[model samples]
Target: MGGRVSEPTTKASQFVVAILAKSGNIVTLYQLDVNNAFLYGDLHEEVNMTLPEGYFTENDKQTEGNMFISLFVYVDDIVITGNDIDEIKRVKTFLNSKFLIKYPGVLKYFLGVEVLRNDENICISQRKYCLELLNDYSMLGSKPANTPIDLGLCVVCSPSEKDNLLSNITKYQKLFGRLIYLTLTRPDISFVVQILSQHMHAPLQSHLNLSFRTLRYLKGSHGKGVRMVKGNELSLKAYCDADLGKCKLNTRSVTGYLVYFCNSLVSWKSKKQATISSSSAEAEYRAMGLTACEIIWIINLLRDLNINVKLHVELMCDNSSAIQIAAYFS
Candidate 1:
């Protein structure tokens, strides 16, 4: 018997790249599922073998020319989109010849994320996932909160006052893990989730309270999600900001960035800096550096997909000092 191996999967960012491309260009998005999908290698020497009960052989494709096909694969599930309809059909047929395939018309839902096509733009959300998360945690009836966390609240690792640790640490871990996944379509809660994730090892009661508050916040805007709009050009821009000494425990800065591809946000992150910054300007500079790295990666990704970015990538930093430093370094 031959052992089965997983297919070479594309990066998760490719999904965002596909969405951005579809919004800006004339392309059709489609989904495919391969029955008993498995990749096999050729035998070194010729060996005769009988077909096991029911078995068969199959095929694949790539992107080029006016015919552009962006394929994203996760195990057996596949998403295919391209500028040329004829090319897409040819590719689909080729795939079908090699393996049993299912054509699910357009890509409406995949991996829990709902894809909705509108006349003007494309909207992706996890509304069903959100509701299910709340229901699972018995938070469906919880009162809705206006914010994920209090604006002025300061979180510390060990509170001066006595605080109790959560008894069922696993429950808190599971809840936190779910919330982290929910951030895929809910960037609004990313910051709070990043903050709470630090205490996963042994969450305290206070941390649980904060996590519940985030759930309440999610309840208030469960329908909230990212929207991908068509852009006039494939230009890249980034916005970066940082809070000096934001982490109460380590005094480390918290930095965040949003990367926009042709006016549509393609990537974002909110996380604490690895090292402490001496000043606000330094923190902002560190944030800018992080954003620059992401922008470079995005540009390379676009280039790989045959999408050329014409203009210079822009980085917007609020701190004048940080900007000056960047200019000097350049």
Candidate 2:
């Protein structure tokens, strides 16, 4: 059963913010929890299994019926969102008749992210999660840093630098994992996290030091997060830039991009390019290609949600040569 289960695309915080910004004061959002959601999913393949010790069925077997409602499920946690109040209520009624469920009024918290809303704007933050992470690392009282990573500092792993490696690899892995999750709401640290994650296999002490520095930066800006305000415009805008051959160890360019829907950031990424490029223009062009794909994806998603985006999507780049190359190639 475990191997057969398929996960659904859970709603991202950025998407939620975008939806809120578009909804303005006309739409009402609601949350629903379907108990034992996995049990509700109909299985296509057949396999015999013994019933639980205390359970019984007509023939010691059970099967689920087809799902009818427009629902999004992430494991057991489900979020039911739409503008039609009557339709949303009808779906809840249907689910209640079939399965045990709970309707938590209005969404304030989902997953680990916190949501705060007013009449005109929605603010998303992970302050509670960030603080807990800091305390777990014994950095609650540590001095705050102005920046997450030092721009001039470059980290590289060397076998000869034995004293520069951490004794416990597990601790380094754990910290790295948490920091990756933190990037969800903290775009400021996305680039640094991308750099530090490369050396996860054999992290050096310098990596550990830089990780702590990121923690100190989080301590200073723990309350900072993304805010989406109501707007009349429905437009897509993207900005992409690349640091040519930024990785000293692998000579790979670092690509970074940020995408916004009506001035609200909804998607972003910071990653290393797969293949090495000889020129800065080539790296920038590759970065633009990646950003273009993301733009098209977002456009398709918006179309699915019935959001009419009539304006042509705009792409911004700093390099004129890259822009000219993209223009010529297209």
User: Each prediction's Cα lDDT score?
Assistant: 0.81, 0.77
Per-residue lDDT of 193-298 in model 1, one digit per residue for the tens? 9898998887788998899999999999999888988877889888999999888879999999988887887888899999999999999999999999888777
Off by over 4 Å in 1: 1-12, 36-64, 159-162
Q: lDDT (0-100) at residue 318 of candidate 2?
A: 95
Highest lDDT: which candidate? 1
Q: Residue by residue across 176-293, what tens digits does model 2's lDDT show?
A: 8988887878899999899989888888888888899999999999999888777778888999999999998779999999988878888888999999989999999999999998
* Decoy 1 TM-score against native: 0.85
* TM-score per candidate: 0.85, 0.85
Off by over 4 Å in 2: 1-7, 11-14, 38-42, 45-70
In the order shown, what is each candidate's alpha-carbon RMSD?
Answer: 7.3, 8.4
